[model samples]
Target: MFGAHTWRCGQRYDETMTLTLAPDVQHHAANAAGRDFVIGDLHGCVDALRYLLHKVGFDAAHDRLFSVGDLVDRGDQCEEALALLDKPWFYAVLGNHEDSLCAVAEGRLARHRWYAIGGGWAQGLSDHALATYAKRLRELPLVRVVGEGETRFNVLHAEFFGDDADLDAGRFDAEVRERMMWGRELAFNAARLPHYALSPTYCGHTPVRELRQIGSQTFIDTGAFIPEGRLTMVEALTSRQWSISVQAARAMGAAEMTLP
Candidate 1:
């Protein structure tokens, strides 16, 4: 973690211009002293998520869990993945996979396009479940800002575009919105990084062989969608980490079916 405290927009500014925090955003730490964990892209691996939580001794009634999103699609447990939205302690940012699912619901994208990109399991969802998941995804914010001062953590699905004004105002044009789901330049280009620096922002989109940390930005997507990959969960404040590989997940009988 960086020592210098990054400056963020004050809360007193005009309400209309500032993007409001996620509905679940903890204005004040829920436990103040309790643990909070952030998981990388899930991609419908509910069994792996469950095993990780069990391994961590997570207390759903107390501890909080934040996800980098892509909670659905690509895996066998898509239905169970959608159910996480109902968990009181769970919070998530919108990932590109969720973005595409939303687009499918709104008729902006063809169903086949979603399937081609590992969304075929959605076809198995009952109409009610599909609608319910869509509604839940609609409620998710593009960003989740947690803590304040040096402890401040920005949770987003992908890279943050350098737009303090638009973000502070809670307004994002099509480009900014698109970038949130698909941008990689910020992570791939070291020189383009400082321009967008802020409180440590945890994001997942570009899958890495392992966790990658550059300054305050941490990318934790370990390609859980691939059979050889693993699910990763990191305690936000403590930085305590836990992982469950695909083989381990299977050995634990985390899921009945294997990923494609």
Candidate 2:
């Protein structure tokens, strides 16, 4: 991929700002000499988030957590979702929902999708706290990099290829939009990873039927929002990646919560 884009605050953040990768942000996946951890979309599934992190034996006090975006939407745990910062974490760029959320907080937009994403749960909170949280969500990072090895791993909400697949990061694929909003097709498609970008991408925009690998790319979005209540995770130790469900890994987590 060419590189990330720069996004100026669109009445989303309370503080005037621009959302872009740090100028120095570049291929780090190739740099991760050893193991690292990455996660898929959250979609307001806070319990799944906590369980997945816990099952992976994530050491927030030390290691890192990278995420594909859309952390808030179509789920019941909005408040707890943003609590990701409670540990070491990175947010790959997501879709317009996040940008829209920021806009609403800046008072530049309305909370139309908020209800769609369970923002109504906060209707009982004081108006000031609601606004405060909105501002916090506005400040989340769009992407992250870890380690420093030959297989630079890039984390993002969705794939970076364009319709032509020849386009750079500034350009995008048509499926990217479909993947961002409705990701049911993410499963069978996991095998086609590196074919999409220069770096091995970890994504969550599309919820796949299973945790499958294609080339070096691995998909982690397990549709925690669904009644099945399963979430996918990637374990990066010594540069090698592994995936396991909380129910499968935690003995008593969510047995029926198997990956599809």
The list of candidate 1 runs beyond 4 A from truth reads: 1-30, 126-129, 163-167, 253-260
* lDDT accuracy of residue 177 in candidate 2: 39
Candidate that scores best on lDDT? 1
In order, what lDDT does every prediction score? 0.71, 0.51
Cα RMSD of all models vs. native, in order, equals: 7.9, 7.1
Which stretches of model 2 miss by more than 4 angstroms?
1-34, 89-96, 125-127, 147-149, 162-197, 212-217, 237-260
After TM-score superposition, the amount by which residue 159's alpha carbon in candidate 2 deviates from its true location, in angstroms, is: 2.2
lDDT of 2 by residue, 119-155 (tens): 5555566657766765555454344444444545666
Rate residue 129 of model 2 by lDDT: 71
Give lDDT for model 2: 0.51
Clashes of each: 6, 29
